[model samples]
Target chain A: MGSIHLPSHEARLACRQNRLTNTAGVAPGYLQANLLILPAQHAADFHDLCLRNPVSCPLVGKTTTPGDAHAVQPAGCIQFPDFDIRTDFPQYRIYQNGEYLESRRDLLDVWTSGHVAFLIGCSFSFEDALTTAGLQPRHQQTGTIVAMYRSNIPLLPAGIFTGGHCIVSMRPYRPEQIDRVREVTRTYLSTHGEPVAWGWEGAKQLGITEINNPDFGEPQVFEEGEVPVFWACGVTPQMAVEAAGDRIKGLVFAHEPGHMLVTDWTSNDLDKLRPGII
Target chain B: MGSIHLPSHEARLACRQNRLTNTAGVAPGYLQANLLILPAQHAADFHDLCLRNPVSCPLVGKTTTPGDAHAVQPAGCIQFPDFDIRTDFPQYRIYQNGEYLESRRDLLDVWTSGHVAFLIGCSFSFEDALTTAGLQPRHQQTGTIVAMYRSNIPLLPAGIFTGGHCIVSMRPYRPEQIDRVREVTRTYLSTHGEPVAWGWEGAKQLGITEINNPDFGEPQVFEEGEVPVFWACGVTPQMAVEAAGDRIKGLVFAHEPGHMLVTDWTSNDLDKLRPGII
Candidate 1:
């Protein structure tokens, strides 16, 4: 039962039935998304935050209207025909007043009609493109989640979502390969396009003090002459929620870090789904 | 006085003093923006509407925080150092509870700390590019404002901003010129990038029944083999506010059509200022 080759629908069904726990490599060609559900009252501000900080929080799709669990395409087609927002993700992390509560297998008991669900594009989609281009990420070779850090890069604040910094994921690449790496990643605009910074000086500029001790995910070992390249991480919205302190009232739900929602869209759909192309 | 060759700073000064009213050809190389100011309570929802419909409401610069009037860059630099949002636009249209009130020379009496200002990218930036590429819009040749019409294209609703259709500006071009037209406009991403529809059949698909009788701007007289080419218009947000029908409360301010905010950024700055490039 290797899940990496499963189609998107079957992979999502496995998560719903509690058969799959980690979604990193599952549904290889399909896009994976980070989930963030908030009360309808707070949906606008969070949506604004994502739009303002698109590098870190590239929005892919969301419920057609507040409280609708089904994510739909702009043309009104349901992106995942049989998808259930509450049960499709392998794990859900619940937070209240900006403090973590606990992780749940599903949101059956927690989901309310008042909640608005947002699906953010994840880096996995671009990683697939990179691998196809023969630039396998270091974390993939090491069998670990990509290293993540909180950078000093400030997010453009929106209403209650204030006082937050960007969260970034790191991958080691040879200095000479940097140009090609950027060219490959920049095409996946909705999934954190291009590297924000690179090299030791770049990390220090972002105020990252300990390169080995990441704020999230496993640490990676860098080889000689290989500089670190940082991409805006999907975990940024989570940090924004945490930084909001008591300003975020009620409950907020997000997919547990590495366990993402496998979407029906593929890397091939990227160009057509761009913001203004339609 | 001639303003097409004026520097951005000086052009903004002229606008502030009412010395320049129509910004169509002013500050030739600089970017111009459509203005939308709402009470803080509606800011998030309107912001969401803009994000959901980037082709029509491409947001470029916005106030640093709610209730602040000065628009700033991502790095905290004031986009126009000596600019004042309330008086900088040549004219302002006032709205209350989704109904048009009256036009004003300035918002000195209406502006308050509870208002949030947003600057949406206008098609003028791309029109400049099209002209530079020898694809001058028909309106420029005819010496009239571009023709605009309300299309049946449904907008992605957010919160209280619902039931709105897309508004588009039209320019007639020969069938063969569209490819070059799209290439020229697509690079100006923040401005309404590329034509959403073209030709008679394309316009019909958008449910635009009255091509010769535009809802706004003077109707264009098409020549032989010339077809209507439509691009998303900045006026869509205004229509959304109108369609909200009392869902919008307090006061709303927008630039009178064709009177926009000229900023310090130039066409060359576009690629660097794109989302996530920072």
Candidate 2:
């Protein structure tokens, strides 16, 4: 009631108390991570899933035991964002064993101990770096969502995680300018790095017709002269979660399409956190 | 006569014909570049001075129009390379306005058309790339003849061009990792991209120890953790032509560092390229 525009932690506390849902554009600079709250029994398998499919789920942080919200890595500035996991996210998919259950925004009633939580890295950070480098994000340029395509390229899976295809994000560029892109994205390999796929010949294998069915978002018309480059998307994990037959229950993910957790980490700082830096 | 393996081109023609002297290794991947054989008439007022300044004194294919050997891009690739000034590379430098400068392995007696030639772009094509990627020439890594030093990084002022601190290549790293060494070499901006400054930190305002100093090549130990990086030794250019105190000579610039003659070409053949694949 005071001033909805500039809400403080106190307001966030109140919101939690009232069970206000939806996290899009919340805590801008601080990370708003994808949460995978699973029973302690499935934690190890989930952890392995994260390790294998790092691009889609670079393991930022996770809890050691079930029901522990305070993971090693925090997506946001706040420690163990206190609130009911069941109902905090704008939506949640309850899967029994792996079968579709029901979607609910609040998991408070279903909240119980012995559930592990995980937070992963996303493309937002690198995208931020690109903007600073003067490479304008094409999606932002068009004021449209980056078209995401389900790729035929399969994701390497961990236990119970199977049949997950890579979700790709494409950006168009002329051949000569690719050197600049490579120069900018070179250091980012640990996060997302350079494009995983390029050229039109390989597009067909990914089920991208460049003409056929429109996928997730509007396709930018690639000029005859430019190459359509694609990067591995972070949505692969969720796709995998949907695939595995009835093992994961009470799955949690960011409901907003492009909304992602923004961490305090910077690419330069990440350079320090890497093995060589240490 | 010496137990050696000179490049086939040099062995078959220049070297065997006694028309070439000095190290042929430097010109291996590059076409044999030459200078002009010009009389003193046209070598006056800035134009003549331009030829001697290392930056612009490119390997002139011919002096006086048709007296020298012309080198190709990838060196030896072009069968009928177009060149006329006079003579081939091994050595070619003549001064009509100045003193009796007779330095030519072939025709030291004749000065055709009295036209002076300029020699430039001494680097072999993409060999820098190969080196950065760590492609070690089987013979060169040992106690070899690559020389390096700290020249006062200098500039051209009208008649004269000052030399900078540079290396003449006497360093060596493990053969196995040379590919990576080559990879980084391609990125060096000298002659092409912004060449890696010879020394680590610039000697800004003096009174500081230059990093890559104490002569050429990394810290002799270069241990397991180190990587050997390189640049187009700036001295090579500065030394190509002598600094004639009074500006009265000829001018030229061999080729851009990478010879990036942008063709009206588009390559969907990503398979043909190495680094950009993924």
Candidate 3:
């Protein structure tokens, strides 16, 4: 607890200086975001893609102008005063013409003047909230990545970003705990609020044929009386980008799945944005 | 409530037979929808547009196949066994190359084999819920149309659906009633749920300079001690379609403002779709 509880600025500085190579369970209480950078030509479609598929993509903030690395200012984020999108993440996944190329420590060398960056809320931000509420996420207990699967549920298509199933992450909890879990997650709207599906039968409706095998993260078994709860995963944007299939210009960039950009916003800051209240 | 309390099937039948010339205050218990029909080529982009701008365009249902009017079957909507999209609405506005041409009683004359239809949830469905909860809509009280404005809040772009401000409906409520109104409205997810802004100051931040001169709908005076409450309106989809400009193929059809497609669903059915409950 002592080492993991770093201020948001120090955590981001660690990533910037390459002192922290991965963000898993680091900087508790701060909100972490999935990063996606695309050429300006696809910016509109990608923005629409996030809006259309909000449960999966939940856009936290986006650059105010294309190629301006420090354009987005997270609501109430007042730390560092100098945030650069190009070199602020622990690691980045580079894609060329919609195909995955390689992972890089920073985008300083590859970023184009035409690139637009989008910061999407990550589920990691709410895990702390769940813990605070006394519900432990199974992945944290097992010290493994959360299990993810490609569901049959089709994403509403947007322009060149067309024809892909929604990607979801899964956790198992007793039926009695489902309501409480949902209530906790509901507050984190920017970070994919609430489970889209619950119970063993629910996954079949989403078109995932196998429970034990997952497309991303490690698979887990359900305990007795436990049901599988599913949520729209941040990986969905990556899948949407891949689905673009050669329609993309030269390059697109994203954080390696589970690796993220830790922002100055606290999990509590996101919870304050509860819908219907404002 | 004698004439307005007709069941869903009876209400739709009245419209189909041209017996009931208008839908407002008719079919009080049933859900009504804003209809939009477009060429099959623009179907994917349109779907994305709805997904991207869900608050403004809550997609209740869409055709399962291109040109198939009977494709969508809302879960538990068993009232209307002989529904047809072509003649079920009281009136429709036709747009060619994104220009408003004329309003017609039915789409039968303009129907094409290359068309797809979307049924967007309307705030009209939630009015009954508000009434049931003892909060009367001001428009109903004034016997006028709901006030709508084009706010500066930019919509997430999708394909040809680019650069349009969100069009919101305004209803004034006493400051004490705002919470009750929000609570009742929050239950209707298929319909636009909850007010985006409350009070005069909130409207200005949304980029609405003149609340009195709305781009659509009739304006009303705020009662003493009443605050301006703004909710995302269905007119948003129309603005997005218009923003597409010449990109739209040949023709697009939508219900005239205040005219809608009465469906077999009840207001309770929509309220039951409460987010995070699943």
TM-score of each: 0.54, 0.41, 0.53
Q: Which ranking of candidates, highest DockQ first? A: 3, 1, 2
Please report, as a residue range, the 10-residue window in candidate 1 chain A with the lowest summed lDDT: A71-80
Better of 2 and 3 by TM-score: 3
Q: Which ten contiguous residues of candidate 2 chain B have the minimum total lDDT?
A: B262-271
Candidate 3 lDDT by residue in tens digits, A80-185: 2457888788888998777889998888888878998888878888888888888878887777778889976555455567656678889889899987887787
* lDDT of residue A207 for candidate 2: 72
DockQ of each: 0.02, 0.01, 0.07
**A121-151 per-residue lDDT for model 1 (tens digits):** 7887788778888888888787787888998
Best DockQ among the predictions, by candidate number: 3
Residue pairs with colliding backbones in model 3 are A51-B52, A52-B51, A52-B52
Against the reference, the lDDT scores of all candidates come to: 0.76, 0.42, 0.74
Interface RMSD of 3: 13.5
Residue-level lDDT of model 2, residues B107-148, one tens digit each, is 435544343443333323334345444564322344232334
Candidate 1 local distance difference test against the native: 0.76
Instruction: Indicate the fraction of true inter-chain contacts that candidate 1 also forms.
Output: 0.00
Angstrom error at residue B140, model 3: 1.3
TM-score of 3: 0.53
Residue A215 of model 3, lDDT score? 93
